[model samples]
Target: MTRDGPDNPARPLAGTDLCALADLADPGSKGFRFRQERLMFAGFVVRVGDEVRGYVDSCPHAGWPLAAWDDRYLTREGDLILCGGHAALFRPLDGVCVAGPCADQRLSPWPVAVIDGRVVTT
Candidate 1:
């Protein structure tokens, strides 16, 4: 048995090391999911230049994974996050819905950190 948050044995627990920051493409997004003892954590990380932000994978409007394709969470122009389920657009810098049915809503934030070139939960 294990608790939620950042202590679980899943791949996303606190101190758990994810891929290197360089593994993610700049100005792009990547999806990740992990489950342990029946608990699941699903999220994505967006990278732009030297900044990276993580958010729960679920969309505010439809409660579905934001990306229809694996690890493809950005718009065609790669400027904002796009919800494939409903075409909702969100600002990658803040995850605030800027257009579509769930306008004004925000994606749940996931604490993360970069240490020695790796991305880890905080």
Candidate 2:
């Protein structure tokens, strides 16, 4: 189910279970990947309060994965998204590029659902 918001949109994720919402620490993020045959899907999830937001792992500036290390998506303060490629910063709540080369661009949204306390693809 898609939450009605400018940041949230309905997306089909090929029926993949990302992780348990409880497994994600508040203000933390996790990366996920789904592959079938030669097709692959990669993204990350950020947990803020009781809400979780999903975004494509790719950086809008260089089309590179934002995290250089596993699940290392946030800045040092854990408030903004950081791109390891070009130091682009994004708003965690909506994946909007706040500062850097990709200013005004956005990370692609990957709609997710909270089902029975688990973060699952919509």
In candidate 2, stretches whose alpha carbon ends up further than 4 angstroms from where it belongs are 1-15
Superposition TM-score, candidate 2 onto the true structure: 0.85
lDDT scores of the candidates, listed in order = 0.84, 0.81
Candidate 2: residue 71 Cα off by (Å) = 0.6
lDDT of 2 by residue, 42-105 (tens): 7799988988999877887887789989999999899999999888999998889999999999
User: Taking the tens digit of each residue's C-alpha lDDT, what string does model 1 give over 36-118?
Assistant: 77777788899888889998888888788889999999998888999999999999989999999999999888878789999
Cα RMSD for candidate 2?
Answer: 5.9
Candidate 1 vs. true structure, TM-score = 0.88
- The window of 10 residues in a row where model 2 has the poorest summed lDDT is 1-10
lDDT of 1: 0.84
